[model samples]
Target: MLGYPIPANETQRLAALHQIKLLDTPDDPVFDRVTRLATRLLNVPIATVTLIDADRQWIKSRVGTDTRETTRKVAFCSHTIAEGAPLVVEDARQDPRFSANPFVDCENGIRFYAGIPIFSSEGYALGSLCVVDTQPRHLHEDELAALKDLTDILNDEIRLREHLTREQQRRAISQRELDALHRSLEEQIERRTRELNLVIESAYDAYISADENHRVLDWNRAAAAMFGWSRQEALGQSLQALIFPHGVPEYDDATPIEVNACRRDGRETPAEVRMKSLRVEGKHRYSLFLHDITERRQLEQLRDREAREDALTQLPNRRALDERLLDAMARARRLQQPLAVLFLDLDGFKAVNDDHGHAVGDELLRDIAKRLRHSVRETDYVARWAGDEFVIVLEGMAPEAIQGLSEKLILTIEAPIQLGEMSLYVSTSIGVASYTPASNETAQELLKRADVAMYEAKQAGKAQVKIAQQGKA
Candidate 1:
């Protein structure tokens, strides 16, 4: 048993369809233009202008598919004509009516379908102008409007052809039929205009259209919401002056532009503006699509900072420090410069924590972190390796400079800390590890040797500096 939808006025429908005399005709470029425009504008690979027949569906024009017609019972366009409205199947496999349908079950996967009914002046649905995609997707309001406009253009072509033939055979067509076709053409133009307005109103992007001189022509609801300017206030204003007050934009596609988008309150926001060329009635214009990426950019920067930085003392974490270490080793080997890694552990740290409680211990660590960071040169990399321990990388330094820096670290830790209501003091055992172009120590091995020297400093009573035995490759 074949399942299909049939028009109630099948006789009248076929009479009107055959009157156009378009059945079994060669591919017309006029029809192909609508099909091509549908495929490109809607971003779908398959588009067709199918005319429904008694037992078959005929393709007047098509894109992507090789088949010229499909069985009426198995045709999606068959259902489109009966409904007499836009038929959108987001996923045919999910619909009970089409789940077991051969086209939906095929290897290519006919998942998405959107068809706009093609009509005659007598209100008969002759066929459909539709698009199909293998992948499932929902059509936005603007996309639906665009599809409808294309169908309206196709119907206009059909009516235009009928009108020309009627004029040539004036004796065959009644005066009443001629009057009806004239009225239909006028109504089609009015409907096409309304459809375009609907597309603009429902667009998600800040749809800003302007003249060649940059005067605003159309400001959509999205543009008003994004720029804090109502449609009435934005009309006739200079587009560049309204958004980019500092200077005209410098175009780059590498990244979305971070422009100073002047707000209604005279403040600025970081907006990403993507401009495109829009041609209206053979006249050139600009379409600016704006999105406020201020919050997104801030979150991106914060995430990057958090990934590399320690939350405790705001110093570079182990991961960030390792990156610097590898980079420093490469530069040191290239420039033939001396590089040093100083591993410092606070002496008597556990005893101080045990005596003063953990609260005092935390404060002491914070204060120590600040002092150690300030103790090194601005060019050096200082990172807290773990609790009570820190590592500093020094590049392009002489052996004498290394010795003075080691002494400076020792003195800085030995300095008294005024911790409210009393004075506190601590010292750090320092281990100095050096690498020159002549040395054979890898980055990790250098740190291991530095750890060995730090143990040696701890063993020979606390608060002393020890140098690692070099060339341990």
Candidate 2:
């Protein structure tokens, strides 16, 4: 049985041990020299720079030993690390802890043992510099001091080996990542090449690709037909001069360059160009994909407008609110200004939906959304939270101003909505909460408080505004 005890903060010690990175490594001459000296000076058959880890004692350098590791429970170095100083046992057979130990009882009987703790610069005991002999021998004070000096040397060597191993592993990992990136780039190039071939074969637009030096590498059938020159003549020509004959003189240097290509019958056609960097055959290159987007640009603009605008009420949706809210919250918090959040819910929306069709109710709700937006300041945001719930975020407002705004919101929604020939009436309940620097609450928590206040308002009356109050203990 081993008498060694682990440190209370063993995790921190082990982390520091790993930081040195000296465990289970190939032999170093720096460590080998000291262990060799330890064997000679201590007059021992075995000398080792032994590191006690979580489960085993690893030999960093072994002068007269063939084994690399031994169980921690039976390791003498474990006791050395625990003692944090030299542990000299003149006779293992007389020492109770080692009397039954295999090293003492077996053929390689250890009667003489002297171990000095190897400590980190920060003073954590890592392992030991130890010497063992079969015959019993006592160590003088001078010999013990010499052993301590030898341990310091071994500690320095272990630290150096750890640093070197970590650096080597880092370089290996970096090289592996670079190799993977290169393979990924090659696969991407092959995939893009196949896609370009398909586009050239089927597309009506004139497509072209070029090297990094701006020399053409690909001239599609459409490009050859559109330009006056055949595919053979246009294969390696300068795209700038050959295509944009009358455009800006420095068009080639301009970013996202646009140009006009001349046809064989002396007709000019418009084209849009985009350039991308690539690698080919171990060399850097660039590619240009051209399109006739004159008519397509109008349709794309229409699509972008539809994407940004809400389809039902034609108002900006929660996505736009999120973008604006981030900026607003940042500016308000920076200035130590207060911002108000209002959670609004329609009082009789479900009744309307059940009585009339959903379509009519939706139209009525859209009318109500327009009214609320018109009532608020242009700087304030009014966004639909869900089916019949909306939220308004007012920036740079005081508590009194927030109270006034919440009341105005309720009054605005309480007014009758004129949908076609019929008049529909609905009420809104609002809960208001403010964000203050003194509160230290998160944005989500503040919003939740506002939501709870809104429910409180709904409970109090059909159409009212309520401010949140902290419940008394």
Candidate 3:
């Protein structure tokens, strides 16, 4: 069999094919629908929405076929891409091109074939939507036209999928950017972002002027550095479309906006954008100033995380725990449901730190923290209260269930922990404080009651739970 010839625009065709991003992608129902319809309408044993890669024809969607791919050198669809129209071979045995093809001699016994080239929007014939049968057959004029129509639909589906993926990604990135912009930045950012309102050419911030129609008219040097685009490449491009391909947002306020813009290398980078509308030479024009904000935002997030998280255990620290208690209490009060606070301290934890250095001690604390978190429901809040002290807020738990949960937590900790070479066992003294409107206790007072109960548990020979006395100091 004669090997299929590559198209004259092979390089451009391959580039266009990769731009669609359909090769080797997961099967989508959109492509499946076309292949399924082709199998039924044409009465062929096999139908496939095949994509020709650099070396193979990947079956994007196939009916009645297990072979996912074959070498492009031997693929019938490879030749179809060259035809730029429907390629019909009524009998493989009579066709010189495919007469000696192994597919003709194989178990597939492929004899009749009809393929319509699937062209990309740029007129690159990437592959084919084809039907194959074991027995020799002829497709009528109407059937050939139907195949072409199906390929046209397949082309639309391919283009739609590419556009939708980019749009979904764009929406996700935009949401993150807007969320960061709206959040309260600390004094440093507040001062910087405030003064950044009026950007001068001398400032490092990128200044750009675009027409009201969103076309870029002027770009500063900083703009080139920020977006990875040279002045020549960015000028005359749609500023709005270049920055936000989906569309300019209908912002909730006229304040400055932060967005991740597409760089020349296709990486999205966080940038602050301030826009103003004015008249330049009596022509309505818009000027925008931009500055990269990735580093600043990352520092903000890091500081925010550290402020509320335990340094050693990486669990919610005391401050976060206190906030959670206030919210949980309010929710319980509104619902008229009972909630419990369990305060626990590791029994003989100091002894372990004394015996095995603080490194092992730190690892033990982290391990127990994970166990405490896993033992409770997602609704429960687990936090490190202090050194060797842990607190948990279990909402909607009845008095009857509190003891069982407390016991489970103790037992969970008793399981041996693997810290390096040592398998160490630990026990806990837990205090249970159940909240009711009758008690009228503040969050701090509730925590104090739980702390007292924990001391009582320790007095009663440790490794046990002591429920706090209701309405008692």
Q: Cα-based RMSD of the predictions, in order?
A: 28.2, 27.2, 36.1
- For residues 1-473, what per-residue lDDT tens digits would candidate 3 score against the true structure? 43788888889999878877778789888889999999988988899988888888899999988999898987998888877778999999889899888989777578999999888777889999999999999899989888888988988887786688668769988988877766645655777755764445356988887887778998878888877777798889997656766565433326888888777777888888887888879887877777789999999999988999999999999999988999998988899899889999999788889999898888899999999989999988999999999999989888898899999998999899987689887899999988885557899989998999999999999999999987443
Q: Model 3, poorest ten-residue lDDT window?
A: 244-253
Tens digit of per-residue lDDT, candidate 1, span 1-473: 66988889889999888888888999999889999999999899999999998999999999999989888887898999999999999999998878888989999879999999999877899999999999999999999999999999988988897787677678555666877787898799789889977887777767888887788998999888877899999989997678777765754445556676888778887787877766789997887777778788899999988998887878888888889999999999898888999999998779778988888888888888999888888999999888888999999888788878888888899898778975678899988889766667788888877888989999999688899888554
* Model number with the top lDDT: 1
Off by over 4 Å in 1: 1-205, 210-216, 220-269, 274-286, 438-442, 471-473
For 298-417, candidate 2 gives per-residue lDDT tens digits of: 788888777656777766666766666667678776888878788899999898889888998999878988998899889888877778888888987778888887788788888888
Which lDDT values do the candidates have, in the order given?
Answer: 0.86, 0.79, 0.86
Badly placed stretches (over 4 Å) of model 2 are 1-4, 9-28, 63-69, 106-108, 120-124, 173-217, 221-473
Weakest lDDT window of 10 consecutive positions for candidate 1: 247-256
The order of the candidates by lDDT, greatest first, is: 1, 3, 2
Which is the better candidate, 1 or 2, if ranked by TM-score?
1
Better of 1 and 3 by lDDT: 1
lDDT of 1 at 410: 85
